[model samples]
Target: MARVETLKRQFFKCLGLLAGCTSFALWASQPQVVEKADKTELEWGNVLFEYYQKDYFEALIEYEYAKTINNDTAKSDYGQMLQGGMLLSYGQAKQSQEIFDRVLARSADPLVRNRAWYYLANLYYHKSEPEKAHQSLAKISGPVPSDLFPEFYHLTSLINSDVENLAQAENILSQVPEDSKHYPYVLFNVAIGQLRSNELKKSLINLTKVNQYAARSEEHASLSDRATHGLAQLALKSGNLPTAWANLQKIRTNGLYSNRGLLTYAWTAIKIKQFNEAIPALEILQSRDIAIPEVQEAKVLLAHLYEQQGAPRKALKSNLISIDEFAKGINRVAEARDIIAKQNVPEEFVRNLDVIIDDSDWFGAQPSIDYQKLTPFLIDLMSSRILNETLKELSDLYAIKKNLENWEFQSNEHLLIMNNADKKSISKEERKAIQRSKAIQQQLSDKKQELKLLMLSLKPEEQKRFQSTIDSIDKEIAILQSRTDGMSRLSQPYKQPASVKKEMKDKHNQVKQKLKQTSRLIAKLEPVVRSLVNEELDKHEERMRYYWAQSRLAKARLYDTTLMELDNVTSNKESGEGVK
Candidate 1:
């Protein structure tokens, strides 16, 4: 019995040893688990995610923590943040380039390298180096980040086009999916290329697609009009005048292509001998403040039509009216110049001339006069010592009023938010909730870390058991984060002080006094400008009358010559009768 018992114990020991060895072998065969990202790396990723979502304020906060980490991922994301101007000014783009270059050269991760290359390409594009941008883009061989794919394809197409590789550009554009936000732009460019290549049918097809897509989006209304204009041009080229006219009529009157379409419509009407139909379109074009290049042609056409209708005097009068209108504009420019020459403007006003011009509502109201045509006048005014000074004072006064209004608006908004928070007693409850949520979040994060560590020691089967628990914890953490997010934002420190309101009030009063003084000075100067303008207008009127009188004199001479010829013909016929 004792020998049997000994055999049983030995058998059990052998079985235990065999099981232990099996376990060791299985562990040895398993691949070594790579360590998951630590807290700082995770935070860096979160910052990048927020930035991707365009939540700039929240991203900025996370960036502050991530920027201190020594990891390559953190550095790469920080560089992107800088490039995006989340925490840095746009002036720091050069610095951002340097950081991206460092990451591209040093990072081991393929995704990081590709991302850095993409950013470098963008910077190069902005710097107007399309060749370098193209080269950087070509370095991206692997799968691109999903969010950047559309921009990637769009930019590649653009660079190809810039390099005059139209075929390549078209090929790249073709790869853009139909559902992509860039699809309309891509299709439009492709259509233009096709049109240039004389592939009219294909171009028309692409243009129709663009029109259909644009019609669904309010933001693309101008694009829709342009596509319609393209269709009109194509129809006209194909000698389908009625089809062309129908397409032209579809363009909205307020659209960007309206002027071109209207001009074409008038020209088409004339081609079809619909004189009356052409007249209204020409009149509208002529009356527009910004002189379209086609206006002169339209005026000549109108004059010819008027003569064809046996209204020579009306044609002459129309020509005179057009000339007078042009002369009046020139006179206004001259008046502005004279005002600058005579005024003794103060330095304060001179310094703020640009701001004054930018903020002035007067220019916006004068839509009849093309602002470009007034460039010389504005330049002279700004360069003039006295006029610039006066203009600057007006600008400063406008700016002061705007600033006061903005301050009051911001103060009211802040007060409303504060009052609501206080009334709801949300401040304290929010603090407590945030603290509790954060505490819970930390506990869950620690558990995740613990699980990750345990997984390294566990067999494959053992590791699977903890995954469900980790996933549950992750969901809980996500919920807690969502609930506390508002509180977290609310707890952020307010940078503006209550005392700013008082300061704004004081500034407002000071600006009011200055505005009154400036207005009075401007009043004193305006009459001088008005007198010069009247003098110039009188000169223009006299010149116009002289031209009109000359035209009438020439007409009278021609008419007298025709009467004399008729009398001579009658005398010839009487002499022939007498000879017979």
Candidate 2:
């Protein structure tokens, strides 16, 4: 059996050499796993069958059985690498890495080593260690499968932000033999790399090559769709309106991109002032997935189209639709509030939405309907009222804190002056000075009370809503009093202990956070309410238009039908009289 195995390897090696040096190198490197196995042959065969059927775990069992055959290094390495690759496919990265590491250490054949390296590089890429992946790729400098060279360059191109490597990636792809099975894939990756590098012209050239190659093959419909869309984007970017529109029209007509492609097409239409042309595309977008940002942009653009068509009111109605959509998006509202911090709510609200919604927002604020008063409709639909209120409350809180700090500093200064007087030695005039110090102490007490009252006024609801918290603070204040002397002096240390200060700060922060949260909720809800009003208004408008169109069409059809009947009756009477 050992002699027969040797003969088989010698024959296979000759065939491999004739196939090419790359194939020979690969075959020489790959471990021949089949062994003079007795019961293990049946078990491993069954495992191979199961692996083909995608039953990885059962196949894994057979793999283990075959590997357990003592003294078969090839079988063991093959089993481990196959299992590792399967595990990697299933997202078990760490286990896959360990298994591949063992395979690399034991495998003597270049082919198996290259395979292991490829898988390891992929694992590293998935783990987000692209640099490590590039390093792993570097180990396969020996004769490799021509088909894998493009993928190698593709991955290397991803190692940096520069376009220089992208050209190298393209050169690698161009090396594929004309008869290579993976020619289309090489071209696709090269084009995608070019696109990333912003070499749009070269990207288009490669994509066109991919399209032509796939067209000749009668396979790869999805690849064709991708290439078509790629060309459309290129055309759009290059201001080749006719060509871009034509390419996008292919995707739209074939219903390939469905909702997504049509949305892109609509923008192209809007770009060329073909406002009405954009309507149908926008309508298709409206009927599809509504959550995508593109759908929202379509709505805004649709409104602009309507405005361009001499319907300003319809335009505002459209913008209002987007505002309502965004209201439901919690993250989007948070984003808007962030903007509100830097800009006024009303002016910035309209314009910020323009920016956030899409670049079409650059068209600036579209004219709204001529409506007197900030109608609950406009308020509910168009305003970020809640954000405004929250901002005001926050400003007031800061102002009150500043006032409190000033009062505390002044009171402390006055007390320190009194203490200095006490420390001084003087005559009867000093006794008079001490009386003056007493008056100053009284004034300081009154001023402290006033400051306390001011703080309470700022948080008027705190005593009622947060009674326990207020009581806790009062208790701490009382404790501080116990530690101080009543000589208009602080019996407690003037400087607060870290623990005490931290406790006070924590309580203050908790209250502040709660207020901010409440204010935000209120702010967020205000737009929702306004949006509800706006939405209701929009719905009413839509229904009215629908009903009016229906009514007019019904009337016109009925009138035509009545006129036909009358003419038929007259013709019948004239015929009867002539016959008589």
Candidate 3:
């Protein structure tokens, strides 16, 4: 009986040992989460992660928070954000330059210094100071971040191009790897350089490569359209009408190349005696925005096509329309020039008027009587009154503009989603989902602030209960964030409704009609406004002249009285001498 009990105990101990080893193996196989050593470092990492994701607003918020902590990395990142125009307008380039200069001058970290130099170079480039840009680029000696390498090379090539150093630009462009996102841009610019140099064969080869890559990737549509347009131009120059037509056909309508492409297409069709094709292309070009420079050319082409089709009256009408458009354009220019000449107000005042006119809500509930003493305030009041009355008279038009803006925003959002879907990347979709979640999280954070305000009104017992609820919300948020961190980058594609698109288009047309009507009203009213402003200024000038004349007369009277006093003194002296 003792031997049987001992055997059972030994077998149980072996089974327990085997179970422990299996648990240890499972633990070893699982992925590990490494915690950052410092709290500030973790926060700084979060800022960098947000920046990498192109969540500039979130990055800026995190950076602002991180700045209170004594961390050099956080300071460097904040400076980088300022220099990159992520947290400010590009108009603040001078301020950005100053921040970069401080980092470059004082940063002990080589990496920080290099980034500062890179951003400084970009600023100089934008400012059109290429020599200074080159100097800034020279300051970057050490290794740069991988993501910035392509930008560095591209900027270098651009600077070379700006200086007309085609050889150097070509050499620099050659260093850009095929897989770089900037590769297509570099290739296009290089082809342009070759074309300018009259290296037709080389240019064609490079352009063809860009076209093929853009088509296969289904990206950079603008670049692809440009490449096709370039090919068309080349074919036309080489007298290859068919090739030119084919190249022009590849270019999508309503693109950067559209007007020129359509015009070229029509001309090429005319060359091939395809009147039917030529007429449609010309008509399409004419139907485009009147603001387009090609509209007049398209009219002439249409007139020619009409004449060829033996429709003399139609051709005459086309010519008449072209002349009418030109006359209207000249009248507009003359009126603008006249206003500028007569209205001698400062440019700043005019710009202020522009702002107030464009945004009715700019003043926010109108200014008080005290504030009306300010020139800007007065101008805003006048402009707001004018715009409000105009809008009231054209209430239907105003409603259309409002609806148009709202529908346009929604349409654009849907279009953006569809465009993102075209990329077909799980990682990208995940990032977008994360961004949406973060936006909601931001709203929740704002709610917490509001809740804190509400706490002031609560009794002690109620406060405690409210605080508990807040704490629970905080915990849920933390859990959501944790889950977000582990989520895979996958999302379903978004498709916008056809009805939404149609509504957007309809609203756009209504807004456009309203704009034209408003423009005509302004055309009549602008002259009156200009005359009033000019009259006011003339009155001011007249008042100044009258004051000057009055001062001159007083001076003359003073001079006459001084002379008389001197003469009287002389006569008195003579009479005293005779009495003696």
Candidate 4:
């Protein structure tokens, strides 16, 4: 029995030494956990194992259980953080925030408090409260263990972006270790933050790092494409055309760039004066069936190139087609308005239908034709028809004026004879004659009043439009009045009132002159204006025909121009080099 006890004691001593060495090794390996632990916490070991195994849900359950047994505030904080992180992994952002808040409020140990604050900041940031998140992160003030430094820097960078404190955010991100799992992510955030702050060169550096570190991540792939495109844009802005082109080419290879990317590339090519190179890309964009705004722009650009290459008709046709396809296609309303104002289907269309307002002879009747019926016909008129129709209407206006003048002259002569008969005696025949003269004068007065009223009623805009006609009628009426006043002074046949003949003649002449001037001016201006209109119509017809022929008969037009030059050149060659 004594020999067995001695052996057992020796075995226990050896076992105690082994346990001491094992505890020392564990402490050396994880000093942060070891120094703070009062006992061997199997719960932390289990929780960490679950986390490493990617069993985040089970790890959270274990951490919650660990929190109940954790006497140290720091350990409890770690457990709560683990729980919150697990909740975040499951997309329970609100629950994660609540746990992080509890850890921050309840944990009193410095390491635990700082960690809780850091994670709580991240929680707030994830919840879009970057200001609150930044405040929480600002509380961390100690040497961060390597494992926690990544989360610290990343969270700091994100919170910096939230508060628009990109520069500080960049500094925090730079402190992260190079070999960290979050290195690439931090670099990307630093670059993006620097970009937001307009630190292009610095941003470029971080972006470069991001490209190197995140090569296998989605962020790496996307960041590469964006950085290349961004560099290209910067190159273009700085006038480095070749570099811009090279960068844009790289961007195009990356599938992440959109049509807008394509457009930028094309425009950059244009800036470098590589018009021909731009043409293919622009044409490809133009040929798309969908009416994307860029497609319209591409068509416009292509059309412009065609124009510069001696293809105005082609350019014009493209513009017309684009307008028809989508009125809002090009996103240039003012440009469209100007184009329509200047070249909208040609001015000749307005002139072609023989739409004339006759101003000559001042009588308003130009066969009393409808102006509305003519608008469409004018728009559709052949170049020759406009000229013919304009002349015909002008003639009709002049003839109508002459008829009106003859009727006025006959009425005046009859009134003069009746007035003379009324002045002779009180005989039945003389009384009847006086009555006839009075009635005739009253009718002439009424007609004059009606013409004066018509003149008075014209709106200013309308009056200005017909001012030439109005002026002419007034001058004619003035001359007629002078002649009538002189006649009345020489012979007053009605003694009842010689004043009546003067007044009646004065009013009649005024009415006649106003009406005549209005009609005549309308007639003259109508034809003159219509002639201008016809000229415009002819021009439009020429343009329309040119565009139609160019689009459908390009070969014919090109051949026609080349044929004469070719013949001259050939004849010269046949004769001699010196032949004229």
TM-score of each: 0.49, 0.45, 0.47, 0.41
Q: Candidate 4: where is the Cα deviation over 4 Å?
A: 1-75, 91-95, 106-110, 145-148, 179-185, 195-218, 238-243, 258-260, 280-580
For candidate 4, the C-alpha RMSD (Å) to the true structure equals: 45.6
- Better lDDT candidate (2, 4): 4
- Evaluate all candidate structures by whole-model CA lDDT and list the values in order: 0.61, 0.56, 0.62, 0.57
* TM-score, cand. 1 vs. native: 0.49
Give a tens-digit lDDT track for model 4, residues 193-310: 7777888888767665665643676655666667666777777777888988986776543244444556777898778777777777776676663223455456556666766667
Clashes of each: 7, 12, 1, 24
Off by over 4 Å in 1: 1-73, 76-93, 108-110, 234-243, 291-301, 331-580
Best by lDDT: 3
Q: Rank by TM-score, descending?
A: 1, 3, 2, 4
- Kindly list the per-residue Cα lDDT of model 2 for residues 1-580, writing each as its tens digit: 4644543454344333333422322312334455566445565666678778876655666666666654253266666677887676544578889988888897887877887888888777656676787678768757664545656555554543223356555556666665665667667777787788788778888787766664454345556666877798878878899888887776633333455577778888878877777899887765543334455556556765775686655655665554455444333333333433432343333323434333243324442321121221232233344433333333333333444455445654655665564555435653454455444434434544543454454445533543453354444334333322232242332453447545655655565665565455545544543454445455434433443344344435445655887899999999999999
Model 3: worst 10 consecutive residues (lDDT sum): 368-377
| lDDT computed for candidate 2 | 0.56
What is the Cα-based TM-score of model 2?
0.45
Model 3 lDDT tens row, 130-163: 8888778777777776767898888876676566
User: In terms of TM-score, how similar is model 3 to the real structure?
Assistant: 0.47
